[model samples]
Target: MTPADCPEKPVVDLRSDTLTRPSAGMRKAMAGAEVGDDVYGEDPTVKRLETVAAEMLGKPCALFLPTGTMANLVAFLAQTRPGDSIILSESAHPIHYENANLSMVAGLLPCVIHDALGKFTADQVEQRIVREDDPHLSWTTLVSVENTTNRGGGACWELHEMESIAALCRRHGMRLHCDGARIFNACAVTNIEARYYAKCCDTLCFCLSKGLGAPAGSLLAGDPETMHKALRFRKMLGGGMRQSGILAAAGLYALEHHLGDLAEDHRRARRFRQALEAEGFEFCLPSPTNILYIRVENSLRAVKTLKRRGVLTLAHGQDQIRAVFHRDIDDKAMEDAIECFKQALALPR
Candidate 1:
């Protein structure tokens, strides 16, 4: 059908899943949440959220932070000393999205491994490890991996590979951390429980703001000793909250009600990919989760065009436009998006 034949619809927002607004149920939970000063460790709702997150992830302890960035950075700060080094993929979030916090705040050296899919083998990490006898080199103290890597088009790392890396870190007297901001998405695709992934790392975090549909919050989990240190670093970084149980309440609601439907987002993503392919468009890579990267000659031009047609998206780089699916997008938005894509592709070069 042509533009005239399509029904009127709200804007199709495929820019990022973080754009998802809190659902009514989540808002209700937030409204009714028990509150106290979390910094003083008196918040009942925050405690419950942390307890539930720790149990589900199989970590002995958990801490609630305002954002995933804080959770990831606190983990790094807690596990390593200043001048220590970290190993992470070129596409890891801390490398790009965290505004150089690892260096400026944590004061650690970053040793990067390049992988287009945002995965590095245990062998790659072993090669990056510094020789302790070499007094001139900073010690490699930590290795971090992203699950459903953001800049890598939401790619998930294999559990076996993670186990290998964890073993290698243990042998080298280093810690393994998973930047699992979208880990639940990985779980949906791989049929793996969050606890198994937690078992492969000394620390990891997952965001409720992204696919979980919370307005704001992230949980960092690890062994009690590491998490004890992490709590101190979180306070140092100003992550202590006064009454964040209101936000934690949304997280609790999401975990209880939203997890089972994540696979549906994956299905919609696949359907969107197939639909776009039928229009002669191509994705930069096939993602198993909600994120998709469409290849275009000029990403900026395509983004502007799609925006004018009432479909919102992000430009991954110079040549790829990214679209992410979340609970906010529905069948109507998906159909409208396809129609807009058909029209956008018909534009004069």
Candidate 2:
């Protein structure tokens, strides 16, 4: 059944930060946004948003795309030729969640490195690089990493580790791309500026729709030359939008208002984790940010029970349930969620 077909609205939705609706202020901004065809680079508000995003990330330029998937795809298209290989963490969103666009759209082979926390070492990246002399192996042309890794229970990568990988990529003439869908959350927890993280990669994409709470948008930032190529790829991929300032306005509002509030979501997540632990639950990883993965005896049962109890969550695996916090859910909802979880865990195995 579809969500619209459901009789009840969830009292607390822990499914994902993507479920957040734009605030009233954001709606007003969107309505008042001045518009021109973004495809022609005439949309002033989109240009403003792009300029602000580029400045924040310390990139020469940025492109506003409809979704993070498109942002990542465009980056790949700009960076790699067909048959080139890219290395990513085994649980990375691009490899596991983006419908294999890397191979299908970019025609790039993937080499995955398995890690418990979704952070890979420079040594692992070096080991995965195929020798350029070997005609049988796809040359590793790019390395991608995810920050506040979705499947890693919102784990953030250490800055030094990322710098090491970036240095290795540079030394080997390989480009590094960051799938930073929840990058702000990482920055919030680590007290690191977004620019430092951006400086570690050749290109990076971050979602405005996730914890940023924009209605829809993602930005791909990089050196001007790469972004110029990405702009073409975005058009080729049907991401060209006319009068896109309406959406860009929401993104701008989100960046200005919601960026700082992300730490509150992290705080709520930690409280939720503590509550779950008190109810005899174990977690797959310590939630340093807004996403939490609870180890359950039967994830299906837990999900069903939580749904019936007016709380929404996702089954992460056969035995893990995933909960994500966002701006939409409040302190009262958090309390209700804790109560719901308590009752759900009390159910028979």
Candidate 3:
């Protein structure tokens, strides 16, 4: 499905990894899945996916949600009571991308901190906390951190930094939540264990559909009590599925085969950036993960030009364009994208 504001035949669609269709392998796995009623909590294959994902992330429990948006929303609601506020970077997905689901469903206010580069510290979190004694201030009860933060140029946070901020949250009696949508990209880029990062937060959600190439699904991991509450929230959000093992099977396959391939995505992103740089295109910086942001002299014209050439991507603003590499996009697609970009830039004034 198309995931961007623009569209084309997609000779090389780099709009977002979410646009990837289920691979042949994923389709095979889905067709053979063992199914049962999941809302009743009896779908064995779905349960297995949750159990295995929880074990991989070192969390006691996991719940499979249809979308990462739902996973994030459920975590927010489960962790904070109504009128409580959740802290996150200004560029965080929940703040800018999730259509205010956190506020609508969770009744939680967002305390946005400006950190466009994805660099924030324990002190930053501490400083953002509001006092309950102030009637004008909302009670800040949760801190949300994003791994390989999307608008942060796909920069990964150091593990120690995550730990320090998480510890500060614990000390301040605030829960820590991680919107780890592309966290495997963080792990692949930093060579860190996913469990290590998982240990640093009280709850976290990761996508199976992005770098992993699963057709759909995200796992929300946390302690059992919190996860039980997440499950209830899932049902309330109409996210509880029946016989969802059919979809969970794809997530299981991705977990087994796709995790190791994320390094390749990062490599392709770097290669793409290098090619663009060679063609005199400007980029914000080197993307350490699968996503890259290109600074164009005229973003709308560039996007229109690329679309006409059968390539697809999104403009970040009037001067920036964003693209992502995934399993489906290979060396050839990158070559085509670079060529299209070169042609677009080389157009006569």
Candidate 4:
């Protein structure tokens, strides 16, 4: 159903940060954005956004794509050959959430490392590395990591750990890629700069639609040569766009205005976590950013009960519910959400 068809504005929408609609200021920017064909590299606004994104990530170049999944696919396609293998945390978005694009589209094999917190040490990477002498194994070519890991309750990878992993990849002649969909959230909470995290990877991409509140788009950044190669894969994957500056303008506005406000979302999420904890709710991990996963007796029933109370959340698993805070949810909405949870807990199974 269309947004206007809803009975009323939701008291709180913890389903995902992607639910955020463009703000008036962002809409104004989109309306005034200049137009050009991006496939031809002539879109002035898109170029500006790419440049800003690259500088922010301390990369030599950046390419804007329609989605974070596409950005990741192109990075893999550019970095690995068809028979090569890549290593990733088993809980990564590509493994569970991206429809197996790494295997289906990129034709790459995956070496999964199971980790509850969505992070694995350099030692784990070494264990997963295939021996080159064993011709039976697919050559491990790339290592990918996610920041503010989605399924891991928005856990951020420590910089030292990332540095160790990057060093290992370099030593093994492998490329490092970062699925930095929530890199800004990590930066906001840890007081680390985006560049430091970007520097730990051979290529990295961050979403404009998630915490940034843009209508659509993600930017992949890396060295110029690799990005040039990725550009072709982007088009091969049908990601080429014409006059995408309208969307890029929203990304630009988000970068300029919405970035500083991410801490507020984190604060709200923490407050929500505290309230749930007080109600005897259990979480898989600490809420470091805007995402939290609460353990419930029956996730589906809890979600239904919360919805009946004008609150919205997602059933993450049979017994887990995921809540994500964003620009759209305010302090009042958060309190209402907490109260709704309390009420849901009081209901009979």
lDDT over C-alpha atoms for residue 273 of model 1: 88
Error of 4 at 198 (Å): 0.8
Model 1, clash count? 0
Candidate 2: residue pairs that collide: none
Per-residue lDDT tens digits for candidate 2, residues 70-112, read 9999999999999999999898888888999999999999999
What is the TM-score of each predicted model, taking all chains together?
0.96, 0.98, 0.95, 0.97
Q: Evaluate model 2: give its lDDT.
A: 0.91
Candidate 3 regions exceeding 4 Å error are 1-8, 347-349
Please give the lDDT score for candidate 4. Answer: 0.91
lDDT of 1: 0.90
Better of 1 and 2 by lDDT: 2
Which prediction has more favorable lDDT, 1 or 4? 4
The CA lDDT of each predicted structure is 0.90, 0.91, 0.87, 0.91
Q: Which sections of candidate 4 miss by over 4 Å? A: 1-8, 347-349
Please provide, for model 1 over 151-249, each residue's C-alpha lDDT reduced to its tens digit, 9 standing for 90 to 100. Answer: 888888778989999999999899999999999999998888999999999998999999889998999999988999999998998889999999999
lDDT of 3: 0.87
lDDT of each residue in 110-172, candidate 4, tens digit only: 999998889899999999897486878899999999998998889998899899999999999
Instruction: For model 1, give the 10-residue run with minimal summed lDDT.
Output: 1-10
